[model samples]
Target chain A: MTDIALRGVDGLKVDYLALVRRRRLYSALLLVLFVALIAGGFDLADSRNAGGFWSGLSQIFDFPVELVREAINKGAALPGNLWRYLPAMIETINIAAVSTLLGAVLAVFLSLLSTRGLARWPRLMPLFRRVMDTMRAIPEIVIALVLIFVLGGGPVPAMIAIAFHTAGALGKLFSEVNENADLKPIEGLSSVGASWFQRMWLGVLPQVMPNYLSYALLRFEINVRASAILGFVGAGGIGAELRVAISWGTGRYDAAAAIFLLLFLTIVAIDQLSSHVRNRLVGGH
Target chain B: MTTLDAGFDLAAAKRDAERRAFRKRMLTFGIPAAVLAYLVYVAIAFDIAGLAARARMDNARILLADMVSHKVHVTRDNRFDKTTVAIEGENKGTYADDQWPAWVVREGASTVVALEAGNVVRFDPDAVRFDIPDYGVLEIVQNRTGITMTMPAGATPEWINASSSRVTVTRPEGRLTVTKTRAEVFRYFGGWELFFFTLDSPFHGKDWAQLAALAVSGERVRAGESNLAAMASDVWNNAMWRHKDVAWAIFETVLMAFLGTMGAAILAVPLAFAAAKNFAPAFPVRFGMRRVFDFLRGVDGLIWTIILSRAFGPGPLTGSLAILFTDTGTFGKLFSEALENVDRKQIDGLRSTGANVVQRNRFGVIPQLAPVIVSQVLYYLESNMRSATVIGAIVGGGIGLLLTQAIQTQKDWEEVTYYIVLTLMMVSATDMLSGWLRSKLIGGR
Candidate 1:
């Protein structure tokens, strides 16, 4: 038996090499396409009257000290200004905050409908799920545009749009959590013939609460950045200033670059804060 | 018997309390339910279709073609022979021509061959010179004044206010078509000529506000009102109304994302290989790579595009490069997790195959990851379709240029609606394409 095993007898293995052998050479060759693209982009960039890299860099920072000071001291009007963007920024966060609040309130109701345990209305679950799916699929911008016209410019339409979307997404997320929850507490309550609400309140709600809170907070962060740009349609926000600056052409790029930096920082900070909270809460549980 | 009766009675009371609490909770749930139902009702009652109709209506440029059916006589300025060219038309028409511009029209069905309306003096703003080949047929339309802009129905006054001559556009559903009136019976509003005479005010800086204000009043040229019919027509007629470019720009934007994501994948695949704990078995390497992924994903593609655009120069190149850098970080993290989940028995089998280190990875690890890596790339490509437009706006490339312009100019909300529709269409198409490609590429699990 030992001599037979030493004869290099491997098990009758499947043809593992078939995939590579039958695979189109292009599958592996796809990497070269990227190399070519990078090279091509660099060349096109190089060939354009595009100033040399040093020159482009130099031009970006060439904001004459005198010019910047002039803009700062004189204050701004419609075309060439910076000071007016503040109110819009504040309004953006306000819309984002109010929208999140509204969405969370709606999500609570949706979550109840979502739970099979509640059995709130036996026939409505499938229809309600379809409604949620459609809402989630529509982009926020599309909702904003349609609502803006009906509501007539302001943060209200934007809030409404964001709220609907958030509720849908949060509802879906919360339902999955509810479905995955431990049934021990509910079962223990039910063994005594306790009602469904009593079981859910003591069981499911508590279990899913942490994930729900974490989700809402993260959503608030996303809504804030999106709200900032709604002003392009005159909905009122910091996005108005951004639109104004961008419209002025390459001349005003630096100002926009500055705004983008702040927006980026805000998102990063929120993500870190939310993640930390979620970890702590989950760990404790 | 007496003790059992007391225990049963206590159990019955407890169960009754639980049932009562459940009933109360169910009753309270009605409040939120009513609110949701009301909102859904409101959504339907609001008439989104009518709103879309109105948005398309307002995008008109107020066709000046019929109202100013007058004529302009372009003549060389007598004061300085070489410098100023003069056009003789009605006072309102001429002045409007100067503030806006008149498309070149000939007396007959010919081109505006004999004349240039604005002067060529160094100080005065010159007209956009069009080289007409012959007096075949030149219906003078204005030079690219308000490139068709799309506004959402929700557009505010801030979005509406825009430069008279420089129209910015955006992405949405339908095209907002504005034809610079092929030069008609129009003259400069300020003077007979389009330019403020260099001979007269060569060095003097004209008060810019009065001129701009004069330009916008009186229906701002009273272009034709467009509904779906107007929009449909504009799609074919307007210079900026072409859908192919919009479609292609969207495609280019998607391509930029794919390239960027691929670039990220290339950089990431190697890093992910090392980052996976199973492969690296080193805490520091894995942690560092994980941090890089977190940081990359944390900043959105919109900001990344802008920042990279600044670091690199402008154009599609910057947008693509941004996609690459951001994708590299994200794909690295995602791919690393996928890499770590791979089967270890395959590694053992690869070793027994007398495979070298490289061959072992090819034979063992790669096969396990092929479907997953491709799936991720396909998914990110789908995501980047929308992201690319937003990013493109900051960078001044792709369809986002139209999106920025439409919203900023507030000339037409329909165009904005059109672009949004197009984006959804683009995403759906790509989603379908990618799904098919993924299934085909993987050839099943």
Candidate 2:
């Protein structure tokens, strides 16, 4: 009886060791495969590239150095260049801000219409979800380019394009927040014979408002970057100005540097501001 | 005395409650009012009123129509007495002599174009005649000196614009333009023509049933390949559509996103440890590393793309490097934060097991960080796919370059539609893939 019990314990120990060994082998194999994939991809990209990776590595700093040198040489005009592009910078900011506002409004409706318990038309929930997915999938540049064709080059195209994307993105996040909301208030509101809009406004919004605002603030930061990039494609902003400056080549790189500085400062400022606000809103909760 | 004290306390509470309610009311109304005022200002600044004048409705109509339909141009060169029928007037889409569309018939010295709804345009040796259904026939003749138009009506309709050098009659069905050198008729038809097979391909006009039959049992169309292979090769190499190039571009875009994202995550993990306060060797290293992250992110992807493209010249590698540089900063920040939040008990438990620092980190810390790292990486992978498109545009590679080129041409709206559909599919596929990967790797969280 003693020998049998000792053998049973020994058998259990052996099985445990085997399991651990198998897990380690699998992990090691996965790591090797991942490394191989990365190396292969790097080689493929290097081959397909116009300039070889080794050659390009040495010249990577050439453009930046030239830009810095020109900016320093034209140091006196730097402030003036910044001032000249201030309005364009403002336009970019305004595009982001207005699009965020419009998108948030649209998102509120979309989220309400798409969320399970909150939806006014419950049967059409999937339809609304698919709409959001399609919108989210489309890159803003695609819409901005198309709208730029119809509407001509301006901030409006960028605004509408960014807003279209923002609505979809924020809608998904808003709906997720809505899913976690307390339903008792909603039930109570409905028991009181409140309208769909009233129940949502009075009950659900109060619960999800903090989360929605935080997400919107984050999206605003992203949208600012998007709007600037759209401007590079001729949606009209500091990006358009940057394109013009860069196209002038070496002599006008000072203006380009000034624009870059403005863009960098603006992005960092907004990033810091939004993160601070988001922390307050979410952390306070 | 007790009743009087209680009543005074109740009155004070009511006053405070009323103040709070008033503030809430102010907030509810004030925010919307501020937003409305700002929108009004934006409207003025962006020139919303001027947009109506600036917007080209004609262009919108053309884009919408061209996206769903194509036009075939029938040209009759007066000097050479030669007639050619081409889809979208492209050289690649020009029909062979005997394979012209049935609607266009060559009879002796004239070509008759039968358009929709009884709108017939005939290009004769001397004159171009357009017979409209409701409106009377319009004749345009180009002499040595100039072009002249005559309509069988009291006044020439606004659709007919006749100048000395050119006479153009535009209709819903078709358009006829008569010039000194050539007389052209554009007949609009639904669906993209020659999208699968160009005019030169033997499989150009085969229906689905015929194609399937050819694929299964029919003899080979070319000498060296089967009918199925021939058909696929023709479609893949179709010059008008460039399906092969498009596939390559999509692959390049995905490659950019993958390499950029994975490379950044790989580069960031070690840096994240250096940046993390609890794991850093010293305070200065952490501070310097954090500053490096900030600088990397602050430069932004746009700046990085411009700088890198100048170095790498315009390709997927440039796009990948740009994404790598920007995302490294983002991943570093996120990863370090995650590292700071790691449970101390796990590392302590590993230490108690007689593990060294490396072993402790490998066994204890990595497992704890795996889920967060995987989830963040997957999320960024999906987002980076979209970014890759934009970067590809800047660097002149991938589907983004194709899209921009199509749009820039200002005439290839159908191609634009194709690219847009492909791009949407590509991004959504990546989105779904990343979501699936995240769920699988992180145990459905």
Q: Which stretch of 10 consecutive residues in model 2 chain B shows the poorest summed lDDT?
A: B1-10
Give stretches of model 2 more than 4 Å off.
A1-11, A248-251, B1-18, B78-80
Q: Candidate 1's residue-wise lDDT over A1-285, tens digit each?
A: 665456534421223345555565665567577588766755554343124445555554343342355445543432333334445566667677767778876776677676686546758878777666555545565566555544556666677777887887777777777777887887888898887777767767778888788888877876775676455544556666666655534446546544544555566777678778877877677
Residues B1-445, candidate 1: write the lDDT tens digits: 3455644787778899999999888877986687677555444444334555544333332112212222243322213322112233223213222332334333332223233333111111122222222212111123444323233344333322334443221112111112333211222232212223221221113355743543444332225642333333433333333465676667566666666666677788898888898888888988987888877766565555544555556666677667776778778877887887899899888789788889988889998998888988887776566556656666766666666666555434445656766776776677678879888988762
Give lDDT for model 2: 0.91
CA lDDT, candidate 1, residue B134 = 27
Colliding residue pairs in candidate 2? none
Most DockQ-accurate candidate: 2
**What TM-score should be assigned to candidate 1?**
0.54
Model 1: CA > 4 A from native: A1-20, A24-26, A29-97, A104-130, A145-158, A178-204, A228-265, A281-285, B1-241, B274-300, B311-315, B337-356, B363-376, B407-414, B431-445
lDDT at A123, model 1: 80
Q: Report lDDT (Cα) of residue B436, candidate 2.
A: 84
lDDT value, residue A72 of candidate 2: 99
lDDT of 2 by residue, B255-364 (tens): 99999999999999999999998999699999999989988888889889988988888899999999999999999999999999999998999899999999999988
The recovered share of true contacts, given per candidate in order, is 0.12, 0.72
